[model samples]
Target: MHSDRGGQYCGNVYRQLLHDHQTVRSQSRRGDCYDNAQAESLWSRLKTEVLEVRERPVFADLADAQRSVADYFDYYNHERRHSRIDYQTMYHSHQQLTTLSTLNCPA
Candidate 1:
């Protein structure tokens, strides 16, 4: 997984967790903040569109937060139309790309 060089990500416990899961850790080079801009933008949208939409703006627990985020991502990938991809949902665009790639591959 990719993340910034924050203390939490740099901690031994976090590194061990990634290692145990066999996930590679990728971090932006020092002094280069643009590397993570896309992820940061997604997080900004998630907080604004999901968390701030509620009056309380806080989840009851970890599971609730996870479920809410999962639901938002489901809507984002399958239901929401994005202008950047000719107004297609992300899932639709991804499927189209996958189909195109499969068709173009050599037999």
Candidate 2:
């Protein structure tokens, strides 16, 4: 996973976990603060579009919160148009990429 220079991510336990799972660890170069800009922007949009638009603005429980977030993600990938991807839904863009990759794959 990708993260900034944090003590929790640097510990031996976290490193061992990643190694055990064969997951590549990505970290920002020292003194580079904008590594998480994309993630931060996504979170800002989620908060604004999902949580802030709710009537109560709070979930009744953990399950409720999870379901709400899951629904939001479904809408985000399927229905929402993003300017970054030429105003196409994430799901559509993913489908196009998958099709292109499959066509380009060599036997």
The best candidate by TM-score is 1
Q: How well does each candidate superpose onto the true structure, as a TM-score?
A: 0.82, 0.71
The TM-score measured for candidate 1 stands at 0.82
Off by over 4 Å in 2: 6-25, 31-34, 55-57
Estimate candidate 1's alpha-carbon lDDT, on a 0 to 1 scale. Answer: 0.91
Question: What lDDT is reached at residue 85 by model 1?
Answer: 88
For residues 1-107, could you state the per-residue lDDT of candidate 2 as single tens digits? 99888999999999999999999999988987788887777778899998888787489899999998899889888998999999999999999999999999998
Each candidate's number of clashing pairs is: 0, 0
Candidate 1 ranges with C-alpha deviation above 4 Å: none
